[model samples]
Target chain A: MINAVKREIPEFIEGYGKVKPFMGAYANIGDVVKTSVKIKSVKPNDKKVLPSIKDALLKCGIKDGMTISFHHHLRNGDYVLNMVLDEIAKLGIKNLTVAASSIFPCHAPLVEHIKNGVVTKIYANYMSGPVAEAVSKGLLKYPAIMHTHGGRARAIESGDLHIDIAFIAAPTCDTYGNINGVEGKSACGSLGYAIPDAMYAEKVVAITDNLVDYPACPIEISQEYVDYVVVVDEIGDPKGIVSGTTRITRDPIGLRIAKLAAQLIDEVGLLKDGFSFQTGAGGTSLAVAAFVKDIMKKKNIKGSFAAGGITGYIVDMFEEGLFKALFDVQCFDLKAVESYKNNKAHQGMSASMYGNPHNKGAVVNNLDVMILGATEVDIDFNVNVTTGSNGIIIGGSGGHSDTAAGAKLAIVVTQLTKARLPIIVDRVTTVTTPGETIDAVVTERGIAINPRRQDLLEKLKDSNLPIFTIEELKNMAEKLTGVPEKIEFEDRIVAVVEYRDGTVIDVVRQVR
Target chain B: MKIVRPAKAGTMESNDIYIMVYPNENGNEIQLDSIVLKQFGNQIKKVIMDTLNELEVENALVVAKDRGALDYTIKARVETAIKRACE
Candidate 1:
């Protein structure tokens, strides 16, 4: 018996890249393999009428230095992340690494955890709020690693991010750990971002307030990947799941920019039947959608589809029969989620299907018109969305480069000056979207057509629109707002920016 | 409003009027009309095609608060409004 026990210890260690043959053997093995041994597993605490999350987590063996992860499906509605972290802190865990898919303002409680030395590292696609402020202030000991959507998935599959435990906040989960976000009290649709984390985490835990019976149909994250199930009360507030500012703008300046963007598409002669479009959920972008909708209605034109992070405004366009379908990668609001689930035309898409440059025929490639926002645009048409006037990481290219390269008409709509800072400059602080892909820039001051598209210039000359060369626009912006001071940097690469086609576009380094 | 003429011919005629009327005090309601097209339908098409060739014009003046109109609403509004005003 002792010999058998001793032999099993070696085999278990061998499973984790200890031996050459074991490493090869492990590669073929699925992330979750069925084992006959009676290993201890966490179970739901059924004694209490309403189970305490604290007890549930303790059962899951969450200890110091364990890597715990959560998905950003709930966005601002996410209470599970903070609740879990609070419980973990109460239980006195230290040196933990929070490997969240993305961090939003709702996860600002994490700043306290970092201060308390409970969480030392963070790995996510995006980070904002107090955590970002803390990071900017050099509060955290370790530098955070921010990745793109596809990059995060690659990191997990390539074994770079070995999550010790993944706590998925499922809106609905079955006893055997089947989960879906479509039909739940806090249904924030499409578990696309959590798919990789659920599959690859060492120990998968599904926490749901709404527990359905066995065999939850349309399982987005399957029971096969999940190891433990914990049921709790009040996972998140559904109201916080959707943003309030998802409507078209009534402001004249924003409306003007929107009209110009639509006109640019019309001038480029892309406002025809079977065209495709992608626009942000921003007020200006939504206004552009409204204008495009007007044109389509007038011309009795129909488009092939609209694609990107789905919004209620786009869903409305789809429902109104302006577009044939909506290829949605992530639902930005509850209305979009409802549309994605009910409307056959609105379909959920994965990162690869939506924008991964490696995929075959991503939806971005077929876009005819794409309206994107920018932090700053240079005379060369290069765009910067990652840094602000003071050269700090404010935003990242969520899908800016992907659509810019794929769309037939890539129109960047931005105000000439933001907070008295010139948006059109000699050189952008960081190049998120290269100039080669950006076709036109629409500012409140004037429309600057990239010289690369002289055809568009010629076509618009007879038109009375105020068209100016990029240099003229740049000078006008500088004249209005004094040229911004250049940012100095010491080279220590913090993050690598990947183009939609999976090539390295540029690298962002830590500021010294 | 004063009238501004195009520099070149075969372009939207300097006098080829395009009108926009918006009903709201803030120019919220927008309408478009062109007199050249009113007299000659095909001529408006020719001018549009020719002018588009010379320059890509995506400009319009918006007059808000039209009680209601059917098809040809924006075009009629543009033509008449341009004939009435300079811009």
Candidate 2:
């Protein structure tokens, strides 16, 4: 079946079973019902503190084939997922589904669990490194479900994921199960990613490095949702909270692309008073944010709010009064964590409220402009951040599609030819974000505005900022990097890439 | 170019092709490992072989570790390794 993006999708993926082919961005909109059935009455002074993770596991009634969850706010530095999984494996639990929000290179040990028949199913928003490689190679018995950040929240709230146990890595937790991410040694700023898990999961466990006094001050996740509190020596490494290089790019070519993107934003008349924005934490994306910062400062344009996974750069803008508020679903760096701890305007929000379409409304809907990065973008403007050119799962659409669907202008900034391979392609191997939602793609060579955005085209048609048709950009990339041979893949489906609306936009096959 | 010594060129970095040339009894062998082996492997190999043929290095063994280097980069690295191997 062909999806809204025009990509052919299988009706029934091998291990994933049935498929719901993507309709269109904003196509699946309306009233969504959420269900919860856990009924609990805590007696006065009932002990919720557990001696160990094993104890918590036993107390939570974890059994074979139970679904467990963990958040990636701690990112690569997170040890809670591994520690809990190791305990679960040691207990001889089989066929458990791990519903981690994201997977990193640090979670390499998960490959063994998948091979050992202990973990058969997996769900995540983003993934990188060994675990992703193993999934792409079809190690897991069941096909992995890769959802967008908003989709994960929607799935959780709509009872689609139905986590049996949610192990939230709380940087700081009180004896009463009150938790926050900004007060411990492994302080990660926002607990936004884990809020839905705590609220909806059958059993919620708070694993904390810092066991603070009762009624932990400035509580992010209050005591009501948590069912257990387990104290650990360390929850995560604060250093790991910062993913890769977050500094503004020094590469002259990268700077050129970012500058073009910021200029395009200005040309489209989105860079004005009360502009709201979001960007990734990559070097090039940071450069775009930096350029945007300069423009806002120079023009004295105050923004309404900057949202998404908050980084220090975004915090800096907020501190400088460039934006009135910050809506942080997760903190990307320590500086952002510190800012969230002190500033009242540096607000935290749950994943559901951040991008989940089924909720009351998402913060993404209020975004004026958002700068995104793409691994590969096709002529149709469909972006692929889920799989690499080698047909391996290296990343996933965390909030890529959600924000793109919501923002007034969704811009994808990337180099024209990365590592001698063209960034623009005929058809992306996987569609992470549908082209209909994307407005512009900025690269070092040129900027291509989606023809769907005729208004943006009309605004920049006469401007001299290297504006080119999407086809022209593709041709330019092909001139340098010759048309690449398609990567071969086996028929066995490995992972299903679901859009924010919980539809299968693309399926990743095992590499041949 | 005559095979005299074992030499290598280019760093193991993004957008650079690292080539190591050695004297081989088995004439003009190429071993390649690349991130883009699926997409541009043949094109990268052709560039290296063409460069080796242009430099007349018939008996040298070239091992190229390519990280998606362009045709020119692959050619230059192959040429540079051949020149150094002759010394």
Q: Best candidate per DockQ, number?
A: 2
Each model's Cα RMSD: 17.1, 1.6
Residue A164, candidate 1: C-alpha displacement in angstroms:
3.7
lDDT of 2 by residue, A1-512 (tens): 88888878989877677888899998899988998748465889798899999999999998999999999998998899999999999999999999999999999999999999999999999999999999999899989999999899999998988999999999889998999888878888888989999999989999998998898988899899889999889887766866532588899999999999999999889999989999988888999999999999999999999999888888889999999999999888768888899999999999999999998889999999989999999999999999988899999999999999999999999999999889999999899999999999999988999999889889987898998898999999999888899889998889999999889998888999
How accurate locally is residue A59 in candidate 2, as Cα lDDT from 0 to 100? 91
Docking class of 2: high
Report how far residue A493 has shifted in candidate 2, in Å.
Answer: 0.6
Cα lDDT, model 1, residue A31: 43
Report the number of the highest-TM-score candidate: 2
Per-candidate TM equals 0.71, 0.97
